[model samples]
Target: MTEVVIAGIGQTRVGEFWDLSLRSLGVRAIRAAIKDSGGLQPQALYAGNMLAANLSRQAHVGTLLADFSGLAGIEAEALEAAGASGAAALRQGYLAVASGLVDVALVVGVEKYTDLIGPGVEAALATTTDSDFEAIHGLTPAAQAALLMRRYQHEFGLPADGLAGFVLTAHANGAGNPNAMYRKAITLEAYQKAEMVSDPLNLFDLAPNADGAAALILTRRDRLPRDFPHPVVQVAASASVSDTLGLHNRPEPLWFAAAQASVEQALKKAGLSREQIDLFEYYDAYSIYAALSLEAAGFAARGQGWKLAAEGESGLQGKIPCATMGGLKARGNPGGATGVYQAVEATLQLRGQAGANQIPDARCALIQALGGPASTAVTHVLKRAD
Candidate 1:
């Protein structure tokens, strides 16, 4: 396999973006990444997105975006994996470059959550679940997460506010991120008093679906310009795994089996030990998911993932820093665009360009994106080419 390095990365600010169309957001990110890559052109493009078909009445977005971005001649396609759509597209770009199928591959994740209003968004979110079993029963992603949180709290004998730490930490980190949706750090008291979106899950517990896009340019390390301006951040390893889409079918609904296996596979492929992972960019669309991911990734013992957050062990200077760029909770979930954002954010950390969120001596980062609980898990290990 060829050495695939992230030559360039770009992203739109995460927010409602009511004025920006999906194509606009995606093309802006694409142009930025192309410019950042020192004029390297892509032989192929992969667009990751969710809800566009249902909400925007638009399908074939890959071709649509390609034409809109003025790259209609290039091969382009859209990848979808529920919320993990962005990472899935990214994986293809990585393979395209690594396999020598293309000298340069462009990957972009874009979503327009504000395209519609009212119950339409909820209906679209349910598209990721088992329509017959889950959606038919009116169980949405939030409702599903609420069920999981309740189960976790019961089985672990945790208090109602046990997950507060994860929420607080994400917001605290997001406060320092300029591209984050919510730039103000939230307080414990504020979290406690926040309105409940789903019972046992308040507004702060879930990441708001927003409109945003992120892009990355990938190529062989040797292909970079002679004087690349930044440190080399390579995709050391990439692995994706899947399990039962419907949460009810899993043996232990609380345990994210796919998430666990993806991380393990990524670690093995990277030839690095768990202790060497300096940071993690977890798909923290919900706080409970973050807790479960911590346990599943081997960072904490079973039924004890929440403790790491409670003890501030996942903070910037903790045993294993996580969600360093606010994560989905504070960064605002860009639907399918999240995985590309994670790659971009992780690359920043590797390049020592995260500004206030920089982790000292950071080298290796594990980034994971999950689709519908642990139904689909895409994990990647990023290392600074030192």
Candidate 2:
């Protein structure tokens, strides 16, 4: 098998894009990525999207984007796996290149949640859960996260301010990212005073749905042109796992077992330990999710994840720096596009191009994407090609 490497990365600012259509957002990122990769022509294009049909009333999105982007003859398809759709698409691209089936693969994750997209986004998100059992009872993502937050505090004897640091850190880092949606850092007081979306899950605890797209070009390491200017970022490992979709069916509602399993497998495949990761790009769809991810990924002891933030251990100078480019919170969760955004951001760090948010000497990064409250987790470990 060949080694898969990311040769290019691109993204649109995460926010409401009332001016651009879905295809337009995708084309911008795809074109940018192609340009970044020294204009490598992709043999295939894979789209990661969740709400094109439900919200945008458009399907066959892969063909549409490929046609619009002037790659009409390339093999194209769309892959969906809830919020982890982007990672799923990336996984496919990785396999395609690693298996020597495609010389160049383009993976693009895009989502539209504003303007004329209609009011079905929330309903569409609910599809990630067990519709018959969970959505029918109005167990929205926020409410589900609140339940976990409340239980975590009660179980750990924590105060209401436990998650405030997580929000603060994300905002502070996001402030330096021009592409972030919430660029203004928040004070502890503001986090505490923010209106509640769900009890125990205030507005700050959740990442709002936005519109964005991120793209990457993947090819075998040996296939990279000798003249390619940028440093290579190899996909050392890609792993995925799944559990019951409904929170009610989970053995431990607060523990993200899938995240733990997927990340553990990916790390093992990469011949690395948790301590070897220079940084992490976790799915922080909610504050509770961030805490759970930290614990599940072995960044902190169980029930001690929140303490990392409380102790200022989640900052840029902390032991395990996270959310370096705002994460899903301040960077804005652009639905299925979020996973690709994580990849693009991680690539920037690995390439030493993250600007103010860059981690000094960052050589390895672990990126994880969650689907439907940890029901599914896709993890990838990337290493700077030496």
Q: Give the worst 10-residue stretch by lDDT in candidate 1.
A: 50-59
Q: Each model's TM-score, in the order given?
A: 0.99, 0.98
Point out the worst 10-residue segment of candidate 2 by lDDT: 115-124
Please write out the lDDT profile of model 1 over residues 120-161, one tens digit for every residue.
899899989999999999999999899999999889986788
How far out, in Å, is residue 168 in model 2? Answer: 0.6
Instruction: Name the TM-score of candidate 2.
Output: 0.98
The residue-by-residue lDDT of candidate 2 on 1-386, one tens digit each, is 68889998989999998899899999999999999998889999999998788778899988998999999999999988888999999999999898888999999999988844443666777777899998888778778889999999999876898988889999999998889999989999998899988898999999979999999999987777789888889999999899898898887898999999999999999999988899899999998888999999999989989999888888888999899999899999988888899999999889898899989989999999999888889999989988
For model 1, the superposed segments whose C-alpha errors exceed 4 Å read: none
Error of 2 at 251 (Å): 1.5
- Candidate 2 overall Cα lDDT vs. reference? 0.90
